[model samples]
Target: MSYKGPEPRRYPTAPWGAGDSATAVESGKLPAIRPIWDVHIRDTIVCLGGDGFYYMTGTTGDNCWAFNDGVELWRSRDLKTWGYLGLVWSIDRDGTWEKNWTARAGVPFRALWAPEIHFIGGNYYICHCISGVGIGVLRSTTQRPEGPYAHVLSDQPIKGGIDSTLFEDDDGKVYLSWGAGQRIREIKPDFSDFAGDWQDLAFDDSGIDPKAKKNGQPLRRVGFEGATFFKANGKYYAGACNKDEGRYSFWFASSDKLLGPYAGRHEGPPGGGGGNLFRDKAGRWWQTFFGNDDQMPFREKPGLIAVEFDAAGHVVASADQPFKPFA
Candidate 1:
């Protein structure tokens, strides 16, 4: 099942035209939402670095489903103005086990998907998955966000799944979860390997997604793909992408404990699937966006939406959401 197709473009040029930049909506303009960068990306994630900048990266490339080079990145100071850092990690150059291509459903592809940047323990870490392969974590050799990144696990994937995300708990223990948050395991403190056995995460009120069913029965899970995990307000939140009534959306479940019997499945931020939630420097909550459905304001461009947790501990888009696509 190796990729035998023509050599795809390595680090395809971003479609940004002259004078274009990664600019956010004007400050203090509560409801004026706009795309940060008018470039193609999916699984958008933004993380605030210890050096006082926000780093953004995701599934990039012209035809990511077929092939692409590696992880691309951009940085912002106040989440307003951004500057590109170019391809920080390349498959053909830096990858050891990750360099091999594989076929998915009879189609040969070798693209990186959903590479999320996390500033954990004063260093940057990226967890990503290859299209038909498994997931791996990379650490910045120089402790910078744009790194000469090397594998945390040198010769193998950390797990076999997609949309892998890392969560650092209050006690400083980091855990890895993936495949729509269906399975989770703690990573060793040194980022070398898994620390324990895989644990299943369940939702007490998991509902069936009409679009995703088996045997004519609806499938119940947090989401079909693009898993995101974070801790906010002392509760562990696990989120993933799902289609709600044909609209790509973000769904989440919360648990008092890390390995939940997480309760309740609720949709947050309509048209905001395949992205993660993050807090800005001012401690304001926001969710990444890359419109993936027809009903959205735009498609395949990186955006952001203001969000806040409800009284019941559910993440919900704020009334003053900067980008109200559904409105």
Candidate 2:
């Protein structure tokens, strides 16, 4: 891997249209809502699909470590209001996807985590990640926001990579970026396997070591998970979440091509955390991230923020602004 260091991205930063959450509340709605209020969805992906609806899917369960429930998908038309669609498919149905599964306290669930859905080639492709098996691509042609997807990746190309995300370039070339030791792989045209070798997306010890500790707590390796990749302004951008030193924050890197020596992987605008970026009707960029709170003891709130490319060629987010339920 040729690491050429950071680039100059002079991106701008501002809020999307002033979304009125207060107006919705006064009109009799929730001030803030955590869709699946019970379990913890540490990471997920949400996007405004081609079908003109906002679709959200994430890892959820009956408890902390068990896959009691499979991945959940939610749909919202107005962004402010959301409703449960159903599981893209669950472990309850397919017990052979994962190995070494033992029953736990409650009803047993399959070991599924960090499932992401991407719409491409006029079809829905889900980048489903199981706990220990590998990442598989599920495809659906049903004309529904929530998909009745089928396992398309018989080869199961990527192994040991979690939080896998799909980014299709302007030329219809597809790339998969996954965390838990960040790596990128290009899918073949047939979608049966990866086209080439897996490329290292992040340096394991670029700046931080795995055993390093900060303020007494162990600091996470800089190669965080839940990476969302996209191409903008003729450059490849990869955004991920990480703990610089025992603290959670959003980070991103840019490259000149689909796979390259990443440049300037760093945190987001001040006070922002992990978020998934999406474009709006006006072609403006906005991100939806969770409030920095432990869902176990407190409520986890999700909100939207605007992002722009700075003049230095860096992506800057409007972190200082408050999250609005609607946009």
- 43-62, model 2: which lDDT tens digit per residue? 54677788777777665543
RMSD of each: 5.6, 12.2
The candidate that wins on lDDT is 1
RMSD of 1: 5.6
lDDT of 1 by residue, 33-52 (tens): 56777678877899999999
In order of listing, the candidates' clash counts read 0, 14
- The list of candidate 1 runs beyond 4 A from truth reads 1-32, 104-107, 206-220, 322-327
Window of ten residues with lowest summed lDDT in model 1: 20-29
* Full-model lDDT for every candidate: 0.78, 0.57
Q: Write down the TM-score of every candidate.
A: 0.86, 0.71
Candidate 2 residue 240 C-alpha distance from true site, Å: 2.5
